[model samples]
Target: MDVRLARKYTVKLSFEEIRLPPFEDILILGKKCPQGRIGVFRSFDFLVPNEFESYEVEDKSVEAVFINKRVLKKINNEKIIEILQERVFPYVSESEIIKVDFKMTIFYDFIEGEL
Candidate 1:
């Protein structure tokens, strides 16, 4: 006999904190500056089992996509566990995560006339 698995659902990205700059800045030439330049940076992306819309089905199952080992190292297992406990547990039922997938990317700024 063969068993069929349930379909997986897509969920919105959830994070502990989504920090965005409140204001934009303009740089003046020939002026002393404390910082070189201002830009937006993504600090972290926290994922919890409960947050997934399909948590009911995905629970007790491990699925993940990873980017790079460096990025993975940045997020310690302890921190991930803490985040899951604090943010995911309250919403999801008890379940085991057997797999995880990670994705990583690097971005750069561009200027006119420059490749």
Candidate 2:
């Protein structure tokens, strides 16, 4: 059996006046900072192309909506929180983070059927 694991990190920012753009939109802005790289995924709509063809190439434009999104690597959670607290806290006044979600996906192939 062979298996693979994948993980993705996403952060959602909400403001009182929709001041903060959607994650995808932010990624398109191409904002640069010492923090990280930020990018947005334009279309969430899904469609099946050439459903009858097994090897047909599908052409679609998944526009990079916002390029302002930033990414920080090799940093601990505590440090991230600290940085957010210091830099973001000042700008956001009594703001609320509606949700924080994490997802992990696993792909596996069985050499001889079900394990």
Candidate 3:
């Protein structure tokens, strides 16, 4: 699966807020600031990104810059659930989660063999 940084939200989490029980990968969709690359991180080890802010899709700043951005070539929804909860859903209301799901474009991880 391949997901683009369609729209982002004001949702943000700090290392303090990020819990660690059944730890798993988080679905990060956007450009990593400073270095600048459309990528994803399974774990947040002091990684901050730019673009993709605001669950209200249109409110995000992705499209024009990262349009057709290439992300991880492989993905597992079941795995990123924890990341979404701690980092994503917390900022938005319980009701808005469903709406966020509708707008995203799912992408997958990339490997060197194909290239």
Top candidate on lDDT is 3
Q: Return the TM-score for candidate 2, rounded to 2 decimals.
A: 0.23
Score candidate 1 by lDDT. Answer: 0.30
Q: For candidate 3, which ten residues in a row score worst on lDDT? A: 63-72
7-100, model 2: which lDDT tens digit per residue? 5679998766443232211121112222222211212112222111111111121111211112222333344345434544334322221111
Task: Superpose all Cα atoms of candidate 2 onto the true structure and report the RMSD in Å to 1 decimal.
Answer: 24.8
Q: Write the per-residue lDDT of candidate 3 for residues 5-109, one digit (tens) a residue.
A: 565669676665664312222222322133222222212223433312222122232211121112222433333344454556445432221223213475669
lDDT of 2: 0.26
**Model 2 ranges off by over 4 Å:** 1-21, 24-73, 95-115
Task: Tell me which of candidates 2 and 3 scores higher on TM-score.
Answer: 2
The superposed Cα distance between candidate 1 and the true structure at residue 108, in angstroms, equals 15
Question: How close is each model in CA RMSD to the real structure?
Answer: 22.7, 24.8, 20.8
Each model's total of backbone clashes:
17, 22, 22
Model 3 segments more than 4 A misplaced: 1-73, 97-115
